[model samples]
Target: MRQSEAIACLREKGYKQATLVLLFAAIDQLAWVAGDKETVGNEGFKAWVQQYMVEKNPELLSGATAADLWGARCGVLHTGVAESNDFRKGYARRILYASNYGQVGSNDPTVLTLSLEWLGSAFAAAIVWFLSDLEADPEKDTRAREKLSRMLVDQQP
Candidate 1:
């Protein structure tokens, strides 16, 4: 819930890269929750994002594969850059971000550009959609609830 609050605040403040880092991390965390797994490896992250984020926000995440997003997430979160081993190894595309109501585009075929605001909004919408889908699937909902119940809480003395 704190992550959700932080993301909401970052999105409101228009911190492009910071917002993206949290967003990607949120997806990773949710993937584990949804699957009732203790941990989500790289493949799990890709699969979850592919099934949830990419499918729900195809228009916003167009031209960027789940692998590409994973690479971007690693780069942004680990190195504070936009290039990762996945990109360097030709397994994923490099991604650049734009802010201030910019459009998503790319000058090179291997490098995709996306709008920060749009990506944030798309991710938010995708969460809503994912939760709705989870509601219809009793098994997944039960798994999600179990995982969510174990999440860390911010307790005050």
Candidate 2:
């Protein structure tokens, strides 16, 4: 299924955590698929992370920053814990959102620090921007179509 369709389904159902996880996974998966799948916790994935965060965190993406975010990703996917010490330490506990910290715990540059709402917005915005890019580049559009088709359809005969 298209990432846009998945985003729409999440928005329609108001699936906050699901949306965050799905989009984060999508960005991470692209990095691995196009970069190196074995570089999850290593410095080798830093470039991919930087590229992925360019849409929202461009001015702040770096090796250290990517590692911090990867820690969060690891906590969720590998450990089933959503706690990132780097993230927790990076952000202040006092940042308020309607008298609370909001869906995300912090807004610190050292951390990914994105709220559920922010994730939805970023995902939607990135999709739009990327689609526009594809429209302008037929090669990219064709490659994406082929890749997506290979993913969604069984090729065994």
Give the number of the best model, judged by TM-score: 1
lDDT score at residue 154, model 1, on the 0-100 scale: 75
Candidate 2 pairs with clashing backbones: none
Measured against the true structure, the TM-scores of the candidates, in listed sequence, are 0.89, 0.54
lDDT of 1 by residue, 1-157 (tens): 6777788798788676788888888988888887756879788788888887788787777567889999999999999898999999998898898874656677788898887776776777778877997999999999898888888767744
Best by lDDT: 1
User: What is the overall TM-score of model 1 with all chains considered together?
Assistant: 0.89
| Cand. 2 Cα-lDDT | 0.50
Q: Number of clashes in model 1?
A: 0
TM-score of 2: 0.54
Model 2 over residues 1-157: C-alpha lDDT tens digits? 3665675588568765565466667666544434323444444344555454544544322223455556655565554555655446653221111111234444454433444444455445545555665688887677666555545433444
Candidates in order: C-alpha RMSD to true structure: 2.1, 6.6
Report how far off residue 33 is in candidate 1 (Å): 0.7
